[model samples]
Target: MPIPRIHEIMEADQRILNAFSPEKLHRLGQAIGLNDSTTVLDLACGKAEMLATWARDYGISGLGVDFSEVFVADARDRVRELGVADRITIEYGDARNFSPRQRFDVACCIGATWIGNGVEGTIELLRQSVTTQGLMLIGEPFWRKAPTAEESVEMGFSADEFSSSLHELVARFTACDLDVVEMFISSEDDWDRYVAPKWLTMRRWLEDNPHDPMFDEVRAELTNSQLSYTRYQRDMLGWGIFGLLER
Candidate 1:
């Protein structure tokens, strides 16, 4: 089997888990109109960074769900650290079928749409907890350009997996019967920030656990992955977080 995700090995949640900086994440949240009265439901919300940040900066109230107990625990502490514990709840659970107690003004699945299979299915899931006039937010990686067969499968994706371009991604929203309200696309620098840390973290783990059986596996995977991401994905991927309202 493939090695576990990098976060599984790290102790604390790093900042900006996805290919976006905290500033861009904040802008994306604000562009979607978050405010004190807004209630958000974030699925697969690793470390609850987005919601917790919103709660701190915009006074938004929210609930975040993730499968990682470690991440959830850290998230709860993060909320308390930011003094938004009362405004946000972080739960340890599967995000795929997480049922919220009430509808929310915003429903988000950032960089984890796989929880609902894909973008289309994730929107359907998010809609389940969205108020009538609420917004749905999804962060997905689209193709900046076509990749070779080898490049495509390196990310466990086929050529058909990603939208052809940024324009196609926008069209996908309307096809799903949602209107695009706003968007935040990541730059090449953002991609580096998100991926470079994984390399450092993994290397450190290998050094610290030289005798561990999985050491070589993790090391090889890390080496291959870093090379693949740098050679293909960094150039081919364009990740964007979109804000949508029902049409």
Candidate 2:
């Protein structure tokens, strides 16, 4: 099975596949100063919602790269639906191997830094595709409160998967010689919006695909996810998008 298949199932009905609302995304677009002249490169851009919306609202043009065929198809459809097909290109490929012909005004890898391994590595990856005067946007999770090793395991991640705190996350940017210029921290409501919808989707999928080979896997995942979210992630974890400028 494709690595993204599980994610595709979990986020089947989602457009923006992260802990962000449309209003917050729009606010972030505005905060980033997007314009008709700004060109963006979005790596691991799920469904290209940000690109399509920014194109329609801010008149920006962009290219989005993703690993999921399903997401790429949806992204293309989204641009057309938004009447911004002329302003955006969605490519289905490994984002890490995407070497753009020209550097972009903004390089973003929201909620998918794993494409470059981690925060520091992802910064180095984005730096290659952004102009010196441009900005890079990264969305990452941090620990709201330090997690016990057992809690981290229950939350479905290794103990060190996230930074110790939001402050530590920002410090990682500084260590990479970049400055955090602006940020959007996810509220509990945002987390609820991102995670809670998966249960309904998974439950429906279970009802519809009773005999599929992955049925049991999905069922187990859904149960574990619910438990993890309630007992650990909701209070112990935080997510945010940070805008970074070169120092």
Best by lDDT: 2
Give the per-residue lDDT of model 2 (tens digit) for 110-221: 9999988899989989989999899999999999898787887777787688899999999999999888999999999999999999999999999999999889899999
Q: State the lDDT at 224 in candidate 1.
A: 81
Runs in model 2 deviating more than 4 A are none
Q: lDDT per residue, candidate 1, 39-138, as tens digits?
A: 9999989888898899999999999998887777778888999999998998888888788789999999999888878888999999999999999999
The TM-scores of all predictions, comma-separated, are 0.93, 0.98
TM-score of 1: 0.93
- lDDT for residue 217 in candidate 2, whole number 0-100: 92
What local lDDT score does residue 203 receive in model 1, on the 0 to 100 scale? Answer: 83
Worst 10 residues of 2 by lDDT: 1-10
